[model samples]
Target: MFKLITELKWSPDGCRVETIPKGEHEDLPERAVEIAIQLSILDQSTGGPNTGQQPEQPEQPEQPEQPEQPEQPEQPEQPEQPEQPEQPEQPEQPEQPSKKVKK
Candidate 1:
């Protein structure tokens, strides 16, 4: 893959100049990239691939199977707790009169 060092003004057919941005030109033709490299417009890329896809990872080793755990014995049902008695209501207090503040 070739990486563009600067903006490329290329005219493949001598008709019009196509402005290519400064970046990887993996989508472009290899020959065009080579010409760009010769003109100091591009450089070789250090990426894995230009296919726009991720590389496949190596297969992982299978792990050893774990032994089956023994079933736990069923627990006995707990006895229900008796309901507690309700508390007596407290007597209501009388409201105090508000004092007038002096300016």
Candidate 2:
């Protein structure tokens, strides 16, 4: 069996052009297909037989979105404490009446 190979490159006009053996044309990279799509070089008839579908891309497993980190519950704002009342001033005692009359 002969081993076939090809090299791909972007043409100045943005086509997915390739270098291959005289009669071999099938087989290309998905990256090539993507570039070609952007450059308008690919359509329904272009990549299917040559590039195929890239082995279905392996599905990427979805990653579950990291569960959103549970939002941390916002840490619940601390309630403000009530102000303490100032202590009342003590009343001064009245001076005792003049000493009882002298004996």
Candidate 3:
């Protein structure tokens, strides 16, 4: 029976690392395809697939138009007041009234 093993290959810049086989190069492509399919399934189950997709919207019922209210009429202004009537003004009363003595 033939066995396959994979190893990581780092670039000289160290910015990227890729998976490579230790011996068999031809099997790497097949393994990569399988891994990609598994990742896609995982993404769909976890709702990650819809992260960039538009959200599903619920259907809204149509609303009826509301009737507009009528504006109120402006009120008329009152005439200006004339000179006040002359009243018979009385003298101011003292704080205490004088008491009458009994004989």
Model 3 shows how many backbone clashes? 0
Q: In candidate 2, what are the lDDT values of residues 13-55, reduced to their tens digit?
A: 4565554242234554555545544444444443365444454
- From the highest lDDT down, the ranking of the candidates is 1, 2, 3
After TM-score superposition, what is the CA distance of residue 56 in candidate 1 from its true location, in Å? 31
Residue 45, candidate 1: Cα error in Å is 4.3
Model 2's alpha-carbon lDDT is: 0.47
CA deviation > 4 Å runs, candidate 3: 1-52, 56-59, 76-103
Candidate 3 has what TM-score? 0.18
lDDT of 1 at 24: 69
Clashes found in each candidate (C-alpha, N, C closer than 3 A): 0, 0, 0
Give the top-scoring candidate (TM-score): 1
Candidate 3 least-lDDT 10 residues:
40-49
Cα-based RMSD of the predictions, in order? 19.6, 12.1, 20.6
The superposed Cα distance between candidate 3 and the true structure at residue 23, in angstroms, equals: 47
Between candidates 1 and 2, the one scoring higher on TM-score is: 1
lDDT for each residue of candidate 3 in 1-103, tens digit (9 for 90 to 100): 1122334343334476675444333223433433433333212233333344443543344588788889888878867666896588989886786676877
User: For each candidate, what TM-score against the reference?
Assistant: 0.38, 0.26, 0.18
Q: Which of 2 and 3 is the better model by TM-score?
A: 2
